[model samples]
Target: MKIILDMMGGDNAPLSNLEGAAQAVKEYGVEIIGLGDEAACRKAAAEKNISLDGIQLVNCTENIEMCDEPARAVRTKKDSSIVVGLNMLKEGKGDAFVSAGSTGALHVGASLIVRTLRGVKRPALATIIPAKNKAYMLLDSGANVECRPEMLAAFAVMGSCYMARVEGRKNPTVALANNGAEESKGTPVLREAHQLLKTTPGINFVGNIEPRDVPNGDVDVVVCDGFTGNVILKLTEGVAKMILGMLKEMFMANVGSKLAYLLLRSGVADLKKKMDSEEYGGAPFLGARQPVIKAHGSSKAKAIKNAIRQAKICVDNDLCGTMQAALDELAAQSAGE
Candidate 1:
């Protein structure tokens, strides 16, 4: 499988992307087509002693900056890594597109260039968030800030398909993120969405899920408007970081604490791994015609490599095809009704 990578898109730019591409090629045996300055990438790879075997470099001069307006930059920066890589995915030159760039730019580029699937109004940004025993997929995680009722219902279906097809979850339970577990607890949009999700065939809609209960691993898919989902995603990250920091400081406080840390070092390491965002790679822009992974802008080689692995998994599982089928079935049911 071929994965198109935006080499010049992230904070670390071409170097980290290059390293990740090399690792992916070696470990996954997948072809990498990097969109960036070919000569500069090759020089950097040489300096770092990283092999670019089985990887092809496409020359891209411009790069979309984080400050650039999403739609405007995507339209004007024709030669940019994001634009070029997305166009390649649209043209079927690659199996998936992976970028650690501006989330807005990647979302805009994917929606405009790759386009959404049939019957899909807007694409949702779906990410695997680590929970108690099982990780749940959160959709609209900063994609569309404001979502319609039917849009949330669509997210439910897409999220369900994603958890099942890519993550191998069976009959994944779907829930709407709400202030309370009650069906009428959220805004009008969410209340209507709740009703819609209850009838969204092929999905195990389990009514509403309070944000607090989300971490309990009871639900497999959590659907929400981008605004709320973004808040949840960021808050979860912040709390995890803060807690980990507090633990580190506590462990280093005194000799007694140090001894306690030594006793729990293995468990602490496991907890750190569980909380690491890098483990899940990146969020997938669901509803797009092709798989588009939105890695963290500050992603290093390990995260980028895992993101590429996610893209491969999405393609291998035919995620888009499965989603389209589910959507078509839903459309048919709606039309019949």
Candidate 2:
């Protein structure tokens, strides 16, 4: 499969993107079409002794900075790497598009260029979070700041389809992120959403899930408005980092602790792997006509490479098509009612 990448979209820019592309090409046997300053990308690859055998670079003059306005930058910077790469996806130049750029800009570009599916009101950003035993999906991670009950229900449906089709979960249990697990809990929006999700066919709608219970991995999909979801995502990252740092400090405090650390090093390493965000690659902009992945703005080579792998899986599974079909079924059900 061919994946289009924004080579100059992240904090590390062309170097990290180029390295990731080379690794994806070599390891995953996927063709990567990079859009950015071709000369700079080539020079970086050469300096690193990285071969671009299965990669193609397309020259893009303009680069979109993080400070630029999302919609405005996308419209004005016609030649920017993010815009050009998204356009390439719209024109069917590649199976999927991956970017480690501004999240707002990526969301705007994907919606305006690739467009949303027929019955999808808004596209939600679905992110995989590593849990106790397995990973769960969080939708509307940072897409729509505000949403209606119907929109939350749609996110649940989309998230369920993704977890089942891509993550290989069968009839994934869906839960609403709320103040409590009781059906009477939460704001009007969430309570309404809970009723809607419970009535929505084809989705395994579980009860509400408090933010504290999210890490327990009891639910397969957690649906919430983008504002709340974004807060949860960031807070989870921050807490994980703090815990790991504290553990490190404690282990190195004295000779006795250092000896204990040696015994627990392997287990700690495994825990670190599970907590690493890079392991899940990037978040997918669900509801778009084609697959669009948004990698972290500060993504390194390893993260970008994994994002490419994530893109390939989405393309191979026809994620967009599956979402469209699921939405269509929901629409049909609504019309009948």
Query: TM-scores across all candidates?
Result: 0.98, 0.98
Which ten contiguous residues of candidate 1 have the minimum total lDDT? 192-201
RMSD, candidate 2, Å: 1.0
Q: What lDDT is reached at residue 21 by model 1?
A: 89
Give the alpha carbon lDDT tens digit for every residue of 231-315 in model 1. Answer: 9899998998898999999999999999999999999999988888888889999999899999987889999999999999999
lDDT, model 2, position 62: 93
lDDT of each: 0.91, 0.91
> For candidate 2, lDDT tens digit of each residue in 1-337?
8999999888998898888888999889999999999999999999989888989999999988889999999999999998999999999999999999988888899889999998777789988988887788999998899989988888988999999998899889999999998999989999899888988878999889998899998889999999998998889889998999999999999999999999998999999999888888899998889999999888899999999998999999999898889988888888899
Off by over 4 Å in 1: none
lDDT of 1 at 61: 85
Residue pairs in candidate 2 whose N, alpha carbon or C atoms collide under 3 angstroms: none
Error of 1 at 292 (Å): 0.8
